[model samples]
Target: MIVSIKADIFNNDKNSSDLSDLMHFFKKGRHRMNLRKIDDFSAFENSQWKQTLSRSDIDFLKEGMTIVDKKEIIVSESPSDSEFRIKEAYCYLQQPLSIVVENYEYEPVFINCIFRNFGNELITAKDRHWLKFENGGGASDNTIKGMIKELFNDTVFTKSKEKYLRCYIIKDSDREYCTINQDDTISIKKLPEAKFRFLKDMQIPYHILYKREKENYMPDSVYNNFLQTANKNDKKKEFSRIYLEFNAHQKDFFDIEKGFSHKGRLKNRKSLQADVQTLFEKLKDGKDLNDRQYTLIGSGLPFPNLKSDFSEKFNAVNRNDLEKRIEHQPLLRSEVNPADQNERNEFEHIINEIKYLL
Candidate 1:
């Protein structure tokens, strides 16, 4: 199928990067917050590295059972006859790609979209949907939660909450609407402490503005107190205390960015520039990204097809590059531009490469 390709599909004037850089980049606070929540050995085990307990060890793994924990429940993985190997267990999570586009030929042809992966990050490999195809299609939160239930075989929730009230409704392909039975618009001023709590919980590394640009922002007094209790370090680390409003919009944006940030350190601007250069190179090279890598692109940025661009630009002749070359277009809202001349040059190089090959 020769799907119509256009320059506007991928072009963006607004600055946007992959979810890796935007969502989860500054999580010095999350690490600290997670540390405080480490009450048991299981808590100490990072969720990323948790061992898959044998099916028999947990009673919930029996075929077709829902494992309940507090208000949450674990439903088994969608029953499938597909392959399941220790090395490739995540290959089974594929469902038809559900996508939606506003207008194939028009201004804002590509709008912003969101994709929620069930905790099992590798599941998207099976198939993908074009956002333009569905009226309001995006990633399915219900599907993801169902997958999560199957993966964990047990749901974890706070003891106080009853009946799984925090369910998220899977809206179209990119947007997952939260159904927390609360007001639609959550404000920053209402939850003054949430911002500080979020920063402390995420442990993000960032520069802040204190006293209206008078001094570099440091952690607020509340954050300092939390750190004192959480860090337990006899010697203090360098603290940049600052007070800033982390309202709902900032929280939502940053939360997604934090989740999508690159795991490695981009210490300085020079280092960041180098990293960005390499990032474009990888995208142009059509690399087969694992779940984390793909998630970095989807969750971090405005473009869904960014990774596909890499695959198309790099592995055009390779048969496995089907998704990357053609099927990888995503419902993107904006495009990220390089901030400096050097960055722009690198970006333009990739764009030219796309023009030549794609």
Candidate 2:
């Protein structure tokens, strides 16, 4: 977390001592400090506060603390003005800003949060499963709206009183794609436009997933494990078998939440049906159907049977196993993509954004 310091806090000897202690405390932890100017007071040598600090403290201020204009959680001595403030030394040391994820128990987001805040600590399987049972599902439109309303209320009514409270939201983009041309190139569309507007209007910081959702980012090993454990009679076992045969592009764009034939559940039902038909038409010439065409056609399943929730079930099982491994190791990057540079970069970008909020 980036802790911002008020320039006025260094105006006196007592405050200077507190600031020095705070700097040392922050240095020992992962948190970074930003020296901010308050009102007309400058934090530099030209200001009256420059005389309060000892030579070493001044040297540390230059070399150690990060100076930035942005404000996150503020550390202040005398109350001036700031939404999230740490007024005293005790509160500063004890309380860190909480990060609000879409679902706290979702392993992909939770593991990243844990990595940013606590580093790579080994978590027990029992505790991990407990988290999974507690709010592990994706947030609905209504749920996201309620969260946005709560954040607005907190910012308007509570934060005005200077009580320290800050939160960052991260959710999947839920983007979908379709084949755009004869070359099998795809065009992506970002879903849930209203939610993006709400977050922006509320001035809340957030990160959206580059892929469709958390399941799309799961490692190949997770799929293999799910296939190994699945019952031979299970429909999802068959679905997993077909899914593993897809190319990288098909896998990346596939909808894990609702398989290719979720017309009833999807808002763009007509467009989805059209895409399926278009892919089918392109491959109907009887020259062997490619991976992309096969994927879009519901893995060659009968139209009536395509509506089965096999994809959702397959996703759930793979996600659960991935969560177990993450709890024990917390190494998302290593498991996410070891060979693909683009995928690795995307994973790193998401993690760095989450860490910045911390």
Candidate 3:
């Protein structure tokens, strides 16, 4: 299997034009260097500069250079494991070089700086999993400091330029993926085989599944935030931001691991109904809430047609109206399973809990 890997290069802590020109120069040589090598070279270069250039100007030059080190990374290419490395360097030379070019100065302004490899793994190819990359074999960015840390290392200098870096993924056609439809509905593709089974086994309430083919690309800023909102305890090192939609009688379904892994009790209905009551109280207290919050709390509740008296009495408003009322009054919906007595009993227990809390 051959999986396409996409990536981008980001340079921070310097001006765009300066960084671009420097990158052009670096590209002229197919070079690789480790952190210590770059640092040693830089130290030697700085010693030479100390004897030749003014201290203030050298400090300014140091401010202009961005440094990086090389590393090796391993990846799976499907049925086989592969490794790659990235060599990068950080340098601090501008004025001295500019002066040297003018012929009056024998001083070298720019230094080759620090270079290292940032590691990235090729997890899969053509939808098939393969062996994991062994450590210390290739150059790459595997750590947070190398991966995206530079972009945030300096706020005033690098934040806006982040737009230059592009991130891409090659997904297989068979699995479900998230898409924003033109009509503003978040849609999903063909869901994973286990997600459906888990939903059924757990009695998750989803009323429909539709093939979503809409294209409404969201800006990276918004999308990036959404990706960052995953559960804190989740081992995010292995997961990317991938979501799919499933229509239960409720609106707005979003969960990725549920599709990938067997999430048996993650969406247990009784707990969800309790969440609905909690959301309502928050609204009653005049809190500002979003559609997702409402949907999350509501998804756990029993809908309008349960024969249970508690459900019939509490489910007074429809979904749309409930959303409107979320400003001041949140509706109560129970997660009721008409066919499963165990589910019904658990739901009743939740209802009693809600009543006691009220």
Tens digits of lDDT, candidate 3, 304-325: 2212321222223232322221
Candidate 3 C-alpha error for residue 200, in Å: 29
Residue 115 miss distance in model 2 (angstroms): 4.5
Query: How large is the C-alpha RMSD of every model relative to the true structure?
Result: 27.1, 9.3, 25.2
RMSD in Å for model 2: 9.3
- TM-scores for every predicted model: 0.16, 0.56, 0.17
Ranking by lDDT: 2, 3, 1
Q: Please give, for residues 1-358, the per-residue lDDT of candidate 1 as tens digits.
A: 0011112211222212321121121121110111111232233132222233333322221221121111111111222233122112211111122222222222011111111111111123112221112331222223333433544332232221212211111111121111122463322212234323422333321111111111111113323443455354422211111112222222122222222344632223233333232332222234433433433333332223433331122211222221122221222211111222332221122222211111
What do the candidate models score in CA lDDT, each in turn? 0.22, 0.46, 0.25
Q: Against the hidden true structure, what lDDT does model 3 obtain?
A: 0.25
- Pick the lDDT winner: 2
Reference-based lDDT, residue 308, model 2: 35
Off by over 4 Å in 3: 1-20, 23-39, 43-57, 64-166, 169-249, 254-358
lDDT at residue 339 of model 3 (Cα atoms) = 27
What is the alpha-carbon lDDT for the whole of candidate 1? Answer: 0.22
